[model samples]
Target: MLADMRDEVFDQDRACQALSHDRDRLVEAMDSGVADIDRLTFPDGPLTLLDLAVHVTMWDEINLGVVTLALRGRPHWSLDPRWETAEAGGALNVGGVRAGRGLTEELIRHRFHAVRQAHIDTIAEIPRSQWEQELPFAHSGSQPRTLGGLCHYVNTPEADPTRKLTYQHAAVHLGATSLSRAAPTGTG
Candidate 1:
């Protein structure tokens, strides 16, 4: 059992490391400060480079909360949109906005490290028993989802629409911002 648990947890650790490493490489690619990225835009509405940075932290916070609850063997939790909107406001209050408004490239990089570490700690602390258990996504899907599965998916270069979209999002922010020689070393 212990051996099996190690394998399960190790995948998650590797996935996390890859994500962090990618972000770290992004920092390297960003030769200029936040001012350089101020014009960062999404083809979609209302999303900027700052919004992407803040959303990453916000989702990290949300994922930690939901996964923690699930690991504790609690019922699936619901995230209030009102609560999320308010939280976004707070992110802005801190240094989540763009160059002159709130955030700097340095600070954004720092928050990514901090929030990603929090996720690493949270995942490490979850018991092995909860790993394969099903976890609810923020929205419903016909497909099933599980804690361990999510870890695996993010780490591995699996082909799926959702995964593709996620990588697309990451590319828009991290890829667009900079380029580095860092090849992803983990499942992702």
Candidate 2:
């Protein structure tokens, strides 16, 4: 299964494109209400919608950071800890889910949009050759995931991918059906 996932990661460009498209649909879906966001039970306990948003945002930012590093061959400047603290502090609005509080709907939308755009830019800038490079024993638990691995996870189905995918897949699966109406006929 890991090997298959590796093959999928090699198709990073496709994964990036898919992720960007899915993110757009997710943002649109979220426009309905905070309740639209999925919930998960964290080890700490049950997570609220706001908590789920923060969790998703964190994963997206981390993936974006990894992709940026892979493309640029260096790390970008990190945001100030204060900003993180502030964001965390506001996580109480949705019953301490660490999301849906302190932030207006528009602000949440813009933040997600910016993250998605950054991912697109990173994907566009990275060369295919770079993505194929092997970094054996370089990625473990603490280190960032390799570009190839990240890409694969995005495009391929997993027995149980990260929770992030559960939220994203819901949006994409729905959008694919809706958007099919706009596709050229005789293709499906």
Taken over the whole model, the C-alpha lDDT of each candidate is 0.47, 0.45
Clashing pairs in 1: 155-187, 155-188, 156-187
Estimate, for each residue in 1-188, the C-alpha lDDT of model 1 and write its tens digit: 01222123234555455456644544444434342232333333455444555555655655667666656555334334453354543543244333323667577767766876777677766666667667745323222356665444333211122232222224434434332223356432
Best candidate, TM-score = 2
lDDT of 2 at 10: 30
| Residue 188 accuracy (lDDT) in model 1 | 28
What are the per-model numbers of colliding residue pairs?
Answer: 3, 5
lDDT of 2: 0.45
| C-alpha RMSD of candidate 2 | 8.2
Question: Using Cα atoms with residue i matched to residue i, what is each candidate's TM-score against the true structure?
Answer: 0.52, 0.55
Residue 60 in candidate 2 has what lDDT?
Answer: 64
Tens-digit lDDT track for model 2 on 1-188? 11222232335445555565556555545665343333233445554433444444555666577556645555333322342343442342233334445577566656666866776667666667667665332333222355565444433222123322321443423323223212122211
Query: With candidate 1 superimposed using the best TM-score fit, by how many Å does residue 69's alpha carbon deviate from the native?
Result: 1.9
